[model samples]
Target: MLEKIFKLSENKTDVKTEVLAGITTFMTMAYILAVNPSILSAAGMDSGAVFTATALAAFVGTLLMAVLANYPFALAPGMGLNAYFAYTVVIGMGYSWEYALTAVFAEGIIFILLSVTNVREAIFNAIPKNLKSAVSVGIGLFIAFVGLQNAHIVMGGATLVELFSVDGYNKLNGVNATMNDVGITVLLAIIGILITGWLVVKNVKGNILWGILITWAIGIVCQFVGIYVPNAEVGCFSLLPDFSHGLSIPSIAPIFCKLQFKGIFTLDFVVILCAFLFVDLFDTIGTLVGVSSKAGMLDKEGKLPKIKGALLADALATTAGAVLGTSTTTTFVESASGVSEGGRTGLTAVTTAILFGLALFLSPIFLAIPSFATAPALIIVGLYMMTNITNIDFDDLSEAIPCYVCIIAMPFFYSISEGISMGIITYVVLNLLTGKAKEKKLSLLMYILAILFVLKYAFL
Candidate 1:
């Protein structure tokens, strides 16, 4: 039955290998189970509910990838997109969480339309390759900065950002922080980064997942030894999961289908939707192409067979994830781990989906994971994304300048959309002025985006 469905022999694979590959993929990306709730809850969503939503979204999205695309890829609420949703849209822009969710829902619908009509490929090709890589690099810096802040390893200061110091943090926030409270967590976060980094360096299969769990365990040990104290006022609590309820799923009622369309037609909302669409489109395409290339799944022309199905699955997953009360769910780059393990058929994805479904019952362990522990995963993932910087052609002045602008603006301006907007505008204007516009053959879509972004800054 499995062979008939997934063509295991046709792909020169067996059930055992595929299942093991799926497990490998799941372990590589399971940090989302802990990190997504930590992020979305910052946007005022219920953390427990977000945990359930995140797992369910991963399950549905990965299953869709299996059935619709028949590929080994797995899906989850994307890392950078969730940060943009929580910190940038909800917190930075003063928009309500419902408003941000509405934008995500609208973006998903647009993605679905674009995917089915084949416009998504055109859009994907329209952007300059260097700029796309720059976007990824910029988001890397942005999210890493967020991780540092989350762990209180970085704080606001006279210089705008400063290293963590117990006295300084207490003075700045008017709170009493000792070595046992925020100080210890910050120290743990630092140690966690080293541990996670070492794991990555050693080629550990589930480095990030193990990093989070080990860090949390260390914190629990610290609490036991009285080196780390639970101070609720300082946002430090016991690092223990409550298994008193005997392991049950949390209710998703807090965030399920809670989309708001009251201000969907506004300009800001349109900007938000475009940002979501832009990121998801390129991220999915890049992951598909890169991973498929690694797996030797691409055809002679460097195109993956059944790419349309893969894209449609991603589109459907994003839409479904919004309805499930999470951020845009897209193909995870960690799927590369599975591919490297010989995951070639949908069987691998099916196995991965089943694991995500099973994860729903392990909410207690996931929910108990503290920000300090998960912060290391974010930082390490940021390091992974930042590695794309090697792909940018720095020798070309026109391309390099815009790419550099895009990369720095993200962390500096503290907004991904701002970085993208500035990058497009800079690219178009610089090329036109330097007489390189016609030479580079900038796409009409690029010009249109540049004009729109300029108007955005000039007016709003």
Candidate 2:
């Protein structure tokens, strides 16, 4: 039955293929199953509640990707966006977690609205194909950046004296400014790069996963041999959600109700939402495109069927998370790993959904897996994502500007929205100046989006 459904002979997919795909998908994205709770834990929220929310979100989202879009894309609470949820909106912006949840809920609703209206499809068609690929790759780089920073792997560097420094530290400063920390981080990054090279050269299957596991194992053995200081919780795995602390959703929407809606009506929030929506939208599109390319699922009409259903699924997943107790529900890029493993169809997603469902019984095992071990996997994925940058046509400066702007500005601006804003504005300005405006894929909605960025950035 499984063989018949996946059409292994046609797609060369089989039980062994599904299991391999499932395992690949699992290894790449296993970090996500844990990352959601870790970020939420920082907000002093109940870990138990966070774990429950994360599992439910992953199960629902992944199933939708598999069953709805018929793609191998995985889903989970988004990484960078959730950090922004915790750090920027909640803490930095002085909104409570509840308000943040409300914003997430709103984003999901907007996603659904656009999808159902088929406005979402129109936008996807309007975007340059390279932009779609770049957005996905850009996000991959963004997530990888987060992983490295968390692992203390990427450090600031200079030509002389310190060469590479940790946290912008310099040795001439003081006693605590010793070079040991920087040394370790550089060493790890180097090993990671070397492993990546080895994988590329050998064309090894599961290179990223294998490299990550190898690095983690090395780190573990180093600790055992008394050569390394361990920052990880090294231990045996336990499979079950840690529901020790009672779970409760934060209720902060009343605060927004009490506050003036004056700012909300302004272009700032709207622009931000548009930016978020665009990234989320394109990210989903690229995943679908890439997976479709692999699975031979593209329609003869040169479109993906049930794409609207997939969008609605994502939007609903976000809403489900906000209510059930987590952050935004974005589709997982790691699901491509499943496709690579032989999961050509939704049955693979079904298996993943089942795993996530059972995960509620085993949250401890998931959480116990340290970020450092997972960091390696993310770094490798980032490398894959970085390859998309090459697709940008540099000979034509018009399209080149937005591509470079979005890529460079995302990490610099520290908000994907701001980066996208810069990209849009740059694109518009470049088109007008270069006399390529006629050739532009201009839409009324896009013009509104560009105008909003200027207002929000300059005046608001």
Candidate 3:
């Protein structure tokens, strides 16, 4: 039955291999369960509720990916997108979390429409390959930056952001600054990075998960030794969580279907929706390109065979996540770990989905894992994604300029959509100036998007 459904033998795999591969994929990305709540809570959502939503969203999304796309990709509330939801939209743009969620829901609907009509593929094919690679690398840097901030390894400043030295001293001012009190936390983060890096270097199968767990245990020990204190700047790694209840469910009703659309119909909100739409669109494409290439899911023309199904699944997941009270849920690049583990079919995705469903019941234990511990996993994954930079062609100045703009703008501007906008606009402008605009011919849709991106930045 399993063979008939997933065609495991044709993909050169058995049930055991697929199961293990699914476990490996789930283990690699499970940090999302911890990390998502930590991020979304800042948007004034209940941490516990967000945890449930995150898990449930992952379960549903991964299941859809398995059955619909028949691919091993997993979906979760994306790391950078969550930050955008919490920091930029809710805080920076002064929109309520509810309205922000409305924007996400809108974007998901747009994604579905585009995917169904096959317009999404046209838009994707319209993007210059160089810019696509750049978007991937840019997102990698952005995620790593977010992880470092979460772990207190990096601190924001009035003039600019500053990196904290391990000694807890500021080199520029020769002063013991903010990190002075949290020196131990900084040290733990460094130790976590080292452990994760070593494990990765050693080719450990579940190195990321192992790194997070080991670092978390060390933090518990630090708390026991009194080196860390709860809710203190220096003791972030040591804060103790309540575990009185062995098993409990956090109510998602607080945020479920709570989207407020009254103020979200404005032009600025439309631009915001477009931002979410483009980020999810390109990110999914880039992830699909990477994971599919590894799984041999791409065809002669470099197209995914079941791309419509895969994209529709992602679209639905984003919609479901918004309704359930979380950020954009999309395909995770970490699924590559499962592919490396010999996952070649939907069975692996199904296995991951089942684990995510189980995670719903274990929210208490999972929530106990602190932001600092999960921070390492994000940082490690960021480093892994950075490898995409090697594929960009630097020799072509026209391509490199936009790619470089994209790579730098994401972390600097703190927005993936902004980075993409800058990259696309630059790509269009540079190509026209270089006299390749007519020769190569930018797609009509790409031109319209480029214009919209300019207006979005200029007016809004």
lDDT of 2 by residue, 273-390 (tens): 5655676677666766767666667789867767777777787777677776677777776676677666876667767777777767765545544445556555666677777777
Better candidate number, 1 or 3, judged by TM-score? 1
lDDT of 1 by residue, 82-119 (tens): 99999899998999888898888888889889889999
Clashes of 2: 11
Q: Order of candidates by lDDT, top first?
A: 1, 3, 2
lDDT for each residue of candidate 3 in 1-460, tens digit (9 for 90 to 100): 9999999888899999999999999988888888888888878999899999999999999999988878888898886788778877887677899999999999899999999999998887788888877887887898888889877778755447777664433544444444333566777788999999999999887788788788888878887877765544333433455667767778898889998989765777876787787777878988988789987889999888898999999999999999999999999988999998899889999999999998888877677787778778878877876787988899988889989998999889887777888888998999988998887678886688789888877787
Worst 10 residues of 2 by lDDT: 232-241
Candidate 2 global Cα RMSD: 5.7
Assess every candidate by TM-score.
Answer: 0.99, 0.78, 0.91
Off by over 4 Å in 3: 165-181, 231-241
Candidate 1 stretches with Cα past 4 Å from truth are none
Q: Rank the candidates by TM-score, best first.
A: 1, 3, 2
Cα TM-score of candidate 3: 0.91
Best by lDDT: 1
Worst 10 residues of 1 by lDDT: 263-272
